[model samples]
Target: MVVGLTGGIGSGKTTVAKLFKNFDTVAVYIADIEAKKLMNSSNVIRTKLIKEFGKETYQDNQLNRPYLANVVFNDKEKLHVLNSIVHPEVRKHFQEFVQLHIKKAYIIYESAILFESNSQQQFNFVISVYVDLEERIKRILERDNSTKQEVLNRINNQWKEDKKLLLSNYVINNYSLQETSNSVENIHNILTQKACSIL
Candidate 1:
């Protein structure tokens, strides 16, 4: 089974994904991490990004993330173009990763933009991690060393949490680590049972 896990900025989706890793039968594929790798390693992506945003997109053969982030977050059209170039590659990589974990009970594809990109249809189930906006802003500010306005700009780019919850098969409130872990454990058990029955 393919499950898509998603949440807004600072919603602790990555932490919940790590908790899911504790389950032996579950495999997790993180789209953002893989996308970063592709951006740095894939010549096609490197060329396209540089062409779109200019040579500063990379420096010393590494992705100049701050520059790219500044360009994209400031312009919705630029961010959309960037996603248009990158998401297809990420989806292809995700498919290959899923194939490698074919025998696992289920694999989770964790993406921040799963719903925004309309990629939720690729999953057998969709899970959205939620956190209150103030807490989310606090977390992002600390973790990213970003200003409140900058963090809010990123948050504004994403679909609202309530909209995501409406589309999700399961919703995990991730204010506390213990509570998030418990929710992941419950979901893991349910997915494993469902996958086993299907087999």
Candidate 2:
């Protein structure tokens, strides 16, 4: 079974994913890890990014994220162009990962833009993690080392929890790590039971 976990910036989806890692499940973080690999490994992607954003977008053959961030984060069209380049590459990588993990009873792919990009349709289940907006902003400030305005700008780009919740098979409101673990376990239990029934 393929499950998806997603949330807007600073919603603790990664924390829930880490909890799932402790289980006998294979979990893939598409946005953070896979995106990094695709940017580094694919010369085509690297060239396109450089052409779109210029040579300063890379340093030592690596993505100069801060330079790119300043470009895309402020310009919606630039960010969309970057996503257009990166998302397809990441999706291909995800498909390959899922194929290789077919033996696993359950597998998870986490992406922040799962719903926004209409990617959740590929998963058997979608889990949306959320937190109070105020709390989420606070967490983003600390985590990303960004000012309030910067964090808010990023948050503004994402779909709100209310919308995501309507589509998600499961919704987790992240308040604390312990609570988040409990929520994941609840979903895990349900998934396990469903898998058993299918057998």
Candidate 3:
């Protein structure tokens, strides 16, 4: 089974995903990591990005993430264009990753914009990780060393918790490590039982 995990910016989705790591399921981080790899390795991606956003998008043979972020986050059209380039590559990578892990009982593909990209339809189940907005903002500020408004801008770009919650099979409220870990363990147990029943 494939599970698509998602949450808003600063919502502790990474923390929740880490908790699931102990289950030995394949976890794919669809945005930051995979997208960076695609940008660095794929000449097609590089050329398209330059054509769409201009040559200033790269530096020293690497994507200038901050520069592109500044441009895309402020311009909705440019952000969509960026996502258009990255999501297809990520999805292809994810399909191959899943094929290699077919023996595993479950695999998780985690993306910040799963819903926005309409990729949830591709998964057997969906988990939405959430944290209080104030806590999320605080974590983002500390983790990213970003200004308050900058953090808020990123948050504003993501789907609200309530909206994602409505569409998810599971909602994991991640406040403390113990709470999040326990939630993952419980979900793992539920998945195992369901899989066993199917067998």
Candidate 4:
């Protein structure tokens, strides 16, 4: 079974994913991290990105993240182009990772834009982590050292929490770590049962 786990910036999705990792039957695949690896290592991705964003897209054979961010972060069309190049490869990598973990009860694919990319349909279940906008902004500012406007801009690009909640099979209000862990534990048990029945 594949579970799509998603949340907006600073919604504690990563922390919840880590909590899920504590369960023996579950495997976790972080899409953003894998996409970064693909962007840096995949020859096809390198060629395509260089063609679109020029040589500055990479420097010394390494991804120039700041340059890429400057190019895409503020431009919706450019961001879409970048995602077009990266998401397909990430999906392929995700399928391979799932196949390798076939013995596991289920796998969680953690992505910040699962719903935005219309990829939630690929999963057996979708989980959304929710936090208040003020809290989310504060968290992002602290974690990313980003300006308020910058963080807001990124947040604006994502689907609203209310809309995501309407689509998610499960919702975790992640204001507190202990509470979040408890939610993860409950969901983990539910997914394990579902996985057993499916298998």
Instruction: Give per-residue CA lDDT, model 2, range 152-173, as digits (tens).
Output: 7788878888999999999998
Clashes of 3: 0
Q: What is the lDDT of residue 113 in candidate 1?
A: 92
Tell me the lDDT of model 4 at 41: 91
| Whole-model Cα lDDT of every candidate shown, in order | 0.92, 0.84, 0.84, 0.93
Pairs of colliding residues, candidate 3: none
In candidate 4, which residue ranges exceed 4 Å CA deviation? none
**Which candidate gets the maximum lDDT versus the true structure?**
4
Residue pairs in collision within model 1: none
Ranking by TM-score: 4, 1, 3, 2
Query: Model 3, range 137-179, lDDT digits (tens) per residue?
Result: 9988889868999988888888888999999999999887888
Residue pairs in collision within model 4: none
Reference-based TM-score, model 4: 0.98
Where does the lowest 10-residue lDDT sum fall in candidate 2? 24-33
Model 1: residues >4 Å from true position, as ranges? none
